[model samples]
Target: MATPSSPFSFLDDLFNRIGERLQPPAWAVHEIQHRAVLFLNHVLQQEPEAQQRLLRQQGRVVRFQWRFVTMEMVATPAGLLDLAPAGSVPELTLTVTDESPFELARATLRGGKPSVQIIGDVQLAAEVNWLVDHVRWDVEDDLARLVGDVPAHTIANGARRVVDALRQFVGGRKPPQAGGPSTGSASTAE
Candidate 1:
């Protein structure tokens, strides 16, 4: 028996088709990569220990791959990140194994790391992992610099609450069943 498809399933199929067909322009991709490197360096600057660790691995390139996007960054002498030169071999490569953006977002909201395929230098990978475990961007501080401390605090608090609510929603929600509508258990729903 063929189960009737839900509206969401139709939308999902449409989006999947669109995503597979559309590719960002090379210039846009390059710009986004440059901006990402700058943001990473900004975060690294906030953590002196992370900088010191990265400085030890200066000149080593690390390539990150997720779906169709690839970004290669090198550790600089100043312990900041910069875009690796074209064709530069990476000392370490980390590929996110998750193919679905929704699944990745759900895992992240649940405070879990996405599955990754790691290759190359073990020490470099360890250092990268340490940085991931230790470093975080201080968005509130940046907002405070732009506005004021009190407003920043209020904004941060509001954002935190919103994130918490999203986490709860994502945690409780069931993934749609293949070939059918989602049939959540009553006990789970409540």
Candidate 2:
């Protein structure tokens, strides 16, 4: 049987072309970077261990690069993150190796990390890696503050189901249920 071609195949090329030709205004980029820092800090506040780890690396700037976007941030003495001053040298740099938005989205949906090239201070890189491995935003908890616990739990559960469905679609394999054999792949007889 022939596989069907995607109608949206051209979207990847179209997005790449647009990305190459168009850059976000400096003000917009700056605002976005600030917002990202704020969000990261909020998540960090929920994890005292993460905050303590960040404090250990205080004043070390880390530059993150993905395609044309770059953000430099430094861990504060108070164990929070702040946007580093323009032209401040980074002690460590992490560049995302994936160039395709579609691929990145698929990987994220499948709960996988994007490929990244690390450079500079090994200790700083290790600290950053530890943070990545442990810290996570508790979206459900945040939602519960606004709407109460039961609704938040229901909403989070529904969202998880939707995300799992999307992950299955993107991965081309259904995750095996507890103690069940996976019939996720194409038939062996085929």
Candidate 3:
């Protein structure tokens, strides 16, 4: 007798097939890389120290990749990032080691770092690590600029709550109590 097929397995296979078939065009990829650089620079601009670090690494190329998508960026003396030529050799390359997009998204939503494999210069890797740890996008500030401060604050708080809920669901654990340690196990004392 043949076993019944799992719906989840079938759905996973279908999604993989669709993803493979829907590869973005080269122009679209380039545009996306450009926009990503712009966003990174915007964040870096907020942190003067980050900009100084990037300025020190000026002219060095760093390639960032996740699965099939790759972008090569060069640090400028102005502390901004520019999209490097596709053919240019990078001094450092950072490849996302995790294959599961869902896991990556979950980690990001929980404010956790995604796993990455670093190749090439150690100094560049250190600089990159420092930037990652220090620089953060000021989403609330940006929203406040577009909308009113009160609405932006409200939206930011709502988003934080949703993220907390998602983290609890995905991690199968309640958020740690403020000023208290997390106990992953369920225990009771009478």
- Candidate that scores best on lDDT: 2
Per-residue lDDT tens digits of candidate 1, residues 1-190?
7664543555556667887799889999999999988899999999999999999999999999987789999999999999999999998999999776767888899888999999999999999999988999999999999999999999999999788778878788654455686466545554
Q: What is the Cα-based TM-score of model 2?
A: 0.87
lDDT against the true structure, each candidate: 0.89, 0.91, 0.87
Identify the runs in model 1 with alpha carbons over 4 angstroms from their true place. Answer: 1-15, 173-190
Cα lDDT tens digits, model 2, 1-190, are 6543455457867888898899889999999999999999999999999999999898999999998889999999999999998889999999999877877898899899999999999999999999998999999999999999999999999999899999998889967678687557756773
Clashing pairs in 1: none
Q: What is the TM-score of each candidate against the true structure?
A: 0.83, 0.87, 0.84
**How well does candidate 2 score on lDDT at residue 101?**
80
- Residues 1-190 of candidate 3: C-alpha lDDT, one tens digit per residue: 6553543555546667887899988889888888888989888899999999999999999998887778899999899899997689999999998765666777887678999999999999999999999898989999999998999999999998988898888778877788697558868999
Candidate 2 Cα misplacement greater than 4 A, ranges? 1-9, 178-190
